[model samples]
Target: MYNIQGYFEVESVNEATALLAAAPHLLVIAGGTDVLIKMHHGQIEKAELLSIRKIKSLQGVVKLEDGTILIGSLTTFTQIANDPVIKENIPVLAEAALTMGGPQIRNVATIGGNICNGATSADSASTLFALDARLKLQSNQGERVVPIQEFYLGPGKVDLKPGELLTQIIISPENYRGYGGHYIKFSMRKAMDIATLGVAVICKVKQGNILEDVRIGLGVAGPTPLRCPEAEAFARGKTISPETIAEIGKLAVKATQARTSWRASKEYREHLVEELTQRALKAAIVKAGGEAIA
Candidate 1:
């Protein structure tokens, strides 16, 4: 049972923003996957919820005239996994979406909620980091765009200001174009489990199997989802060989600040970061039309 104080259903961004401005204590709820569970556990008591589920503008996937992809905040994991535009332009995100929980959960878990919850283990975080995604935040005052990397303040925390809501997730063409990407979630179980470690790799392959560029993102490895810049810098302009991948894997470990938890030991998570980085990078290389390294 929830200790409810109030519940407000909003129909548009403007309405939601106005409500938020008036009731700063109101917690924004979309899918309620994380919020309801917390409320049920007494983590949140006497909570006032402002539901954004009825806001149509905050739903669906759209490709803009500039070729950028705009994913509305309320877009579900199931919708992301099956969307033709997402699959064609950013299949890595789709793959991550499919690995989240089970079918029923995916159908109701909005990407907005997942991101707003600010969990490092969230399946989509690493992929979004790798893609250099940006967030569009709106308020009754106005709107602003923030780079995804800057959005996370700490574990279970984000940079949402009072009266502001995440409206859309934006991925520019320069980030996804010509890049083949892959996401690997390391968990104890194949389903209904959070990632102990998640790895996402995106790379562009040049002639003769050289890596034109590469980006690696890791989740549950630090206070927030992080990119392995050292490894990415090392891989850029390097030939995609077994030796190169091995070195890159080791370098990727430097980016992690993993800590022991009930789900995994710090050492074990580090091992996954290294090993899975190699595997994910290899798969991404292949997807980018590079030869597979044995």
Candidate 2:
């Protein structure tokens, strides 16, 4: 730890941004789920605090004047998971929220907190990647909307400036159509455990045989949440049969090998991603009014 400090809970994004620009290395706090853990464990550099929890504008669900649904950054995971609008409009996101932490964690931890942390295994991000989520960054300078896939620069990093705050998540109306999705996370236990591996697969089913617009993204399988376009292309338009699903699994492993460099060799991770992806796809297919392809 670098040093100690008190909290400054600013009520507005502009206020938070000004505070951030002034502080040399302030660790922004929201919900305090992750920060408090690091503060207790001495894992994070010590610094002054800029808390965004009190910013009310950052805590609501809004369907904009346009058709896009705007999810406020400070909206808790529980809010997302339980919101009927979210469940009806973007159920995959709601499903992802359910897997975040325990109920208490879901109550306090915010979506902004998850994205800002930028961990590869961040459950929210992996799901969002498949949804083609867009993030809004607000600052004293201005605001910018960045596609979620491009928002992350590296692990524990994002494309944010010193005075920037991720203020909103935008999901387009086209993405609101019902689809099958599964977010499977591998951890030691079911609750309150970080994922060792996680997979999210979302796709539309057509004519009971063809797979259309398939998306496969992984958590803890890359430096940032990654979509396997190659795997997706190979899987799309294919029959949802077991042999075909297995082939898609293999392609997913091939996609991972193109990027991952592992000391343990890519075999195990590839296997996990493939297995998890297949399981996830099976679950999703069931939800999409189809039986598992056996």
Candidate 3:
């Protein structure tokens, strides 16, 4: 492992910002699940390390005045998965977090780290994109919010400023209503393997018939987590049926091809998008009907 000369445990956003500004080359570690692993693997050079783990205010759950749910940046996957409120209200997030890793990793991984890392195989971001979530960012300049969908410019790239820190994850509870959803992944093995592809499809049925809103997001199918807008458009306002779902899945393939950068090739991911979209959509329908979705 490389030598980290020093450690700074920052308790506030301003403190973290000042440190980051002073040491641009320093590594920021939240949960240490990714950064520490990289360091252990010698993929990273050790410099100053800023641990935001001591930032107390950044670790709880909050419900906004508008009925939105705001999970602090450091909130763990285990917290998200087990929270009754999350399960009762936005179960899709819970479902996504459940697939994140085993119990130990879940205990230490933070939602903010997952989103900001911009990994194509990141499990949490797949459903986060589908949910139209927003990110709250902070720095010495103060704080600002950005939609999660727009936060990423490319793989391993994000829009955060030099001194910025990811502070919160904001999700509107309203959009989650009547939604049937699921996150499905293809990996060599279940637990720790990087997903070959991860897919999330969340749908809200209006009047229990027409699709009111539909979101489809895929991971490892692209350079970044992104929604299949065409697939969503194709599904919206339509009645769900095997035939209609097939059409929407085709739109997923088309949308993914035009928008996403294929790490392997467009052909493989495009086809997986089609198949997974179909599977996820059907699974979501089953979830909505009070039946188990495989």
TM-score of each: 0.99, 0.92, 0.91
User: Which window of ten consecutive residues has the lowest lDDT sum in model 1?
Assistant: 285-294
Which residue pairs of candidate 1 clash?
A: none
RMSD of each: 0.7, 2.5, 2.7
lDDT of each: 0.95, 0.82, 0.81
lDDT of 3 by residue, 1-294 (tens): 757878888888788888887876667899999888878888777567899998988887877777898889899999999887788877878888888889999999998898878787888988988888989988776789999888988888889888789998988977676787888987767787777778998887666556777898888766788788877877778876777888988888765533334334567667888888888888887776633333
Q: How would you order the candidates by lDDT, starting with the best? A: 1, 2, 3
Candidate 1 runs further than 4 Å off:
none
**Candidate 1, lDDT over the whole model:** 0.95
Poorest 10 consecutive residues of model 3 by lDDT?
Answer: 256-265
The residue ranges of model 2 lying beyond 4 angstroms of the native Cα positions read: 1-3, 257-266
Candidate 2 per-residue lDDT, tens place, 140-244, comes to: 788999999898888788888777889999988766565778888877787888876778888888887678767888887777888888888988788779997
TM-score of 3: 0.91
Count of backbone clashes, every candidate in sequence: 0, 1, 0
**Worst lDDT 10-window in candidate 2:** 257-266
For candidate 2, the TM-score is: 0.92
